[model samples]
Target: MCAYQEAGGTDMKTKNQSPRPALPRTPMTVERGVALIEALVALLIMAFGMVALAGIQSTMRRGSDQALQRGEALRLAQGEMETLRDYSVLSAEAAASGPAGTRAYAGVVSAAASSAGGNTDFSVTRSVADWADPVVGQEQQQAGLREVRVRVQWQDRAGNEQFVMLDSFIARADPALGASLGLPASTSATRRPAERSVSIPVAAKDLGNGTSVFVPSPTATVAWVFNNMTGVITGRCTVAMGTLNSSLTAADVAGCSNNTVGYLLSGVVKFSSAARPDPAQPGGTAWPLDVGIVNSTLNGAISAPVHQCFDDAPTSAANTMAFVSFNCFVEPNNGTPRIWSGRLELSGLNLGGGADAKKVCRYSADYDGNGSVSNSEHPENYNAVSGSLSRQNFLVINATASCPAGAAINPENGVFVNNSTVQQQPR
Candidate 1:
């Protein structure tokens, strides 16, 4: 080994040793970018989480805002309803506060911004209507009621419109509401149900027998006449021989006083013509009017039914809208004994829908206590608590003070036809 070392080769194994046989070439430890891949994946997952969190946050914010807005709208509606509750006074159509102040019975109003600045955000409106509800309260009472509707509207953050409403009924606040009647709703006693109009046709001035409007059976303490003549076939309930017939009489309309006046003569009136106004005649003896009666009944008992036509017609005759109808009922009907007629109970519908609905003196059936049909509805049965209306002026009879001869006002059954040879018909 020493001699070889002196040679030119110089022991390649000891000198170079081929770099220790190249260490088998470690294979260069190639990397497939796994760390970078892991980093990218982690970044993507983090981005997804951030996006989810952001969405959740936005949804929560919107939900919270919506809840808040709804609460505010509810509060506004409640406040308005409470204000109406405190009105106390009832029947605002007549005497709500004695003066011109319209607090409770301010009538219905259009949607007006509650905020004086006209902030389109919130608006408030009220609807006041006259109603006679018998079963509204506990048990039964003749309550002059008014329905009040309060509405509050708003827009949510999402630009969606939202609203709230409050509806309820209130009674009359007349100083003598509970005082005058004594027995609650017993003051204006009426028959269980109104008699439907008869189909028979009676002559214009025929005669029949009856007592008071209520006591038409069993002959009571009063005497009245009727128009149930022989030629007038449909007895019981009667209709006119022709449409627009003046001094018309049908079967035993309620009863009649003497040979002229009749009461409770309601039946289906098959109009000869469609009962339209005759513009050629301003105010004739019997002007035709498109009148219809809607007496809503449930289980054979008469409850107050609001007529659509009456509600839609103008309260004032001067309105240019063309139609006019008013609900009419007699106050103090059973007591006080109105010799002619007393104050009337009235309601309003469609009072102001475009035209200025006004109450004019020139009416078709309205009477002003002069036994004349001017301000009152004669032969009208709008009062669910009273008998069919008595005619005025042309056959307008008296409500109290003994029917001509001498008779006490009886609410029970009776046919007050004494022996009158002039207009006596088979008692």
Candidate 2:
């Protein structure tokens, strides 16, 4: 019985040890699990690396695009700068021509922008900023140079922006040569002591609108007075008509016509120096004098044409009066402002005349052939004709005043020109 028990126990022990031996050899499932875990870890690492690489590529692309856009923008700005530099009078002309919209530059270019890089693009635009008042230039400043600024702005696809700017100075090229002629540079200024008013007479009736006539003045000689200190030039005392007639003979008229008459006359008077008026004579005087006649052909025929003038009416407002027919220089200041300078010669034949009836009258530079016939005619002698004048032999009037420095003279310098057909007449 003892031996049987021992055998049973051994058998039980053997049975228990039989499976234990194989189990310890390898953990197959655990190994598989660990392998799976490693595989998963490697996949995760690879995925992360790929994601990082993609991000780097995206950043690189954005950077490159941005660089390209910036380079293009710089190029565009340079091109625009070059374009603005070519215009000499950019400001004065900008109102007529200006830039407003996107324009292609150097071709093959596109630009845009957005929250994301490289979403927006670049385009060009322009505008002007004025730096001065136009009217004040004439009224107060006398000489006004307007400044115009041009700005160009651009944008890129990456939502980046850039801009360029340019400026120009513009003024009247042929402004009044008054300062050179002893005239004040502007109307607001004072007249110098040496300045004297000249009396230029004319017969408004005899000479038709387009007729170029030479009429002699009572004063044969006159002096152009200039003020070096003040830059003012004025017309001085004129010689009497009786003295002027002493040099000519009736036979001189025969060459022009059967009833030979003086129609127009114009000559220049020069002085050695600008001098003050003769205190004794109560008239203006200047230094050495040089007188010479000028013969100039008219650009257009002198004929009666529509003339318009504005005068203060009963309403106390400036309004246009009756239209007169006369020759005129057309200059538009914003609109039509009819202003002219010349002589009005009358004919003895046009106006019935007798002895002691002087037909000729002198005229100053201030003459506007506008408004009523009287407004454009010589106000002092509205009914008198200078003489029975021959249209063939007209005197060319040297009406222009020269600058002491050899510059041209005009009212723009500050002196008030009569610019009227009439003058200080017996009102």
Candidate 3:
């Protein structure tokens, strides 16, 4: 009281009389640290993305490897095909006549071989076994022809097996090759007709008929060059099919400038892989002959006019070369006519001729109750008959059912092909 009286402080403190109430206390702010959780979530998503990317990368790598392997296999197959084309000889004459390095066409299918292709160990194989599958490859097969396939096989890193194949054909008639190889110009005596700008041949018009018939002709086949290309790379020349001689003649659409003739008669026969012969059937009976040697010359000397027909067929039932219906026209050169007196023998292909050379088709024919085939018909048999009297099937003539006086063949005429078309390559 004394101090207030001395300074009159009461007047100076006149504001809100009571001491100013303390402002209400604000509660302390708090935060729930969510950044860490968000960061964790982002990391998890990133991890998943990384895993997916890793999977994609692995898949791409494997695919690349597979592509490379496939290409390599294809290349290997192509190389093998080229090698075969360069080294193979169609006949024994060609083999012997080849300049130096030539080998038999049969040798091309020797065996499967191993080679290195990139990082893979590849197996390479050549075969005409496709003929056993019937029409699967009939376009490239014929009496004087063989279809060769070059296959390459390898294993991938994923433990999967992979393969690629290249298909081609080899014909006994490659004039260009024959000429280049310097092979002799010999013709098979078997009679046939050729046509078009190119002409093939038939041995001889029978000099006589029936038992007195003699085979073969000379200068009938004109020089032709087989392209030696695959059906894939090239196509075949063909004439619309019809009756053998009556309606269709080689000269109708195509004919040899020379006496040349070519006849290709075909029909499908069921077959399997180059399979084994059936044990159920008697030996040699399980399959048809691998190579059939028919001497069109009956009375004439077995010379250049000899017919060398090499073939493979689909004989699934027999588990060997397939049985294809075969019919060709041949008669006495004298125009006489023949009967059943010429039921010839034939041979077989199996165990012996498959594993390697000398085994491709060891034959077995037992005609005349001989019980066995003479052995002299082996290697030496190609050029000429090494053994004259073996039990193999020979010319089975078509009988004289009806005789039109002035028929195309008159009494007995042969059937033949007229034209051929090619694909992928030029004539």
Candidate 4:
């Protein structure tokens, strides 16, 4: 009985500890299926990550492109501002409204804008008062600075407005010339007395080869005297249709053209013909003049070291040289030439230049003996003239001179003249 009971107990214990039938032998198929599910989930996660990365890259690219565009536009505006700093003055003819409505200086700016794909907007206004005036920050003096503003704007990819502004200030009359509009009397006293007298006889024989007088040689000890007349340099100019039907003879020129009146004489030019004293009328009257062309008249008169002529005909044929020249108040324009009319927007000045002027005139001054050419060639030409007075291109005196003793001649000293042909038309 005892043995039977022990055997039974042992059999029961063995049956219970049968190793659980090796856990029913796991199915390889199920394991593989599970592995696939895990792999798919991982793949899905990776795909989501890739999609997010692509979106980010696309956004970044668009932003970058917009930024690039803005940068280019800003650069355009800044470049325009920088480019105009040296050319603020315009000739009277260039300042005049021709059959075409554009002024010489404005035409130049427009041409530049067109060539640049019209990426910017330009406008010019003149002022004879304080530019930064009303004494916003400082004392209100004559403050004759021509303010030029170039505003640039564009849309970003996000449809946001982007803009950049460039500002330029130019002096209509350079203080150095002693002809500044609001110059104090004390300052004028410090300057050397002007000696250019209108009575000085200009020898016609002295024409050509860098000479001003047209008087025949040996006009003998000609004496030039100043009228000693002084008048306010008013910006007001009167325009009239004097005698259009009159003959084109030099005699009728006086009645047909606009006259500039100023008594405070900085310099005097002597010419023979009272009716048509100069053939290069604009070249003589408008050369180097800083009649205000600015954004705000309050910014003051546009002044720069410029040449002014009181006559219609050139004193001498050689006097065709101009540091700055504007053909007409307006020229044939808008992709074609017709009687268009518009006001002038003086923006910059033609800094001193003879070398560049000489080079350009060589190509553009074709009608050298006939009349004047536009001063829109290049400011570098002005710089060339300013580089040295001895370059023999064009000479503008800063102060008046007395006859003989006070006389100042262009191409002074080291200047040499050449009989080279001028080029005006484009190739």
Estimate every model's Cα lDDT from 0 to 1. 0.36, 0.30, 0.38, 0.31
- Candidate 3 lDDT by residue in tens digits, 1-427: 3535325346545743766677987655443657788999999999999999999999998899899999988888888877766645455566787678776654556468888867779988877642443534233233335578888988998889989988887554433333323434446432233321111112211111110111111211212211111101011123333222223232332332223222211111222232333212213322344333344233433333222232334344345432333222212121112111121224353322233211222222221112322232222132222112211222111111111111111111231111111010000
After superposition, which runs of candidate 4 have C-alpha atoms over 4 Å from their true positions?
A: 1-32, 88-90, 94-132, 136-142, 174-427
Tell me the lDDT of candidate 4: 0.31
Clashes of each: 33, 50, 52, 71
Model 1: residue 387 alpha-carbon error in angstroms: 7.9
lDDT of 2 at 207: 21
For residue 215, model 4's alpha carbon misses the true position, in angstroms, by 49
On TM-score, the leading prediction is: 3
RMSD value for candidate 1: 21.0
lDDT of 1 by residue, 1-427 (tens): 4555545656756785544445466554566587899999999999999999999999998788777766777787777776665542334454354566645433332344474212236788777666544443222123345677878777766788877888887554433233334444442212222222231122123233422222221222222232232111122232333223233333445433343322232221110111222222223222122233343222353433322111123334343432222222212122322112222222232223333221111112211112222222432222233333322212111111111222222223242211111100001
lDDT of 4 by residue, 19-136 (tens): 5555567767765678788899999999999999999999998878766766776767766655544333233364464344333232223222311223323322222223454424
Question: All candidates' TM-scores?
Answer: 0.35, 0.28, 0.39, 0.31
Which order, best to worst by lDDT?
A: 3, 1, 4, 2
The segments of candidate 3 whose C-alpha lies over 4 angstroms from its true place after superposition are 2-30, 91-100, 130-142, 175-427
Model 2 reaches what TM-score against the true structure? 0.28
Model 2 weakest 10-residue run by lDDT: 389-398
Model 1 CA lDDT for position 260: 35
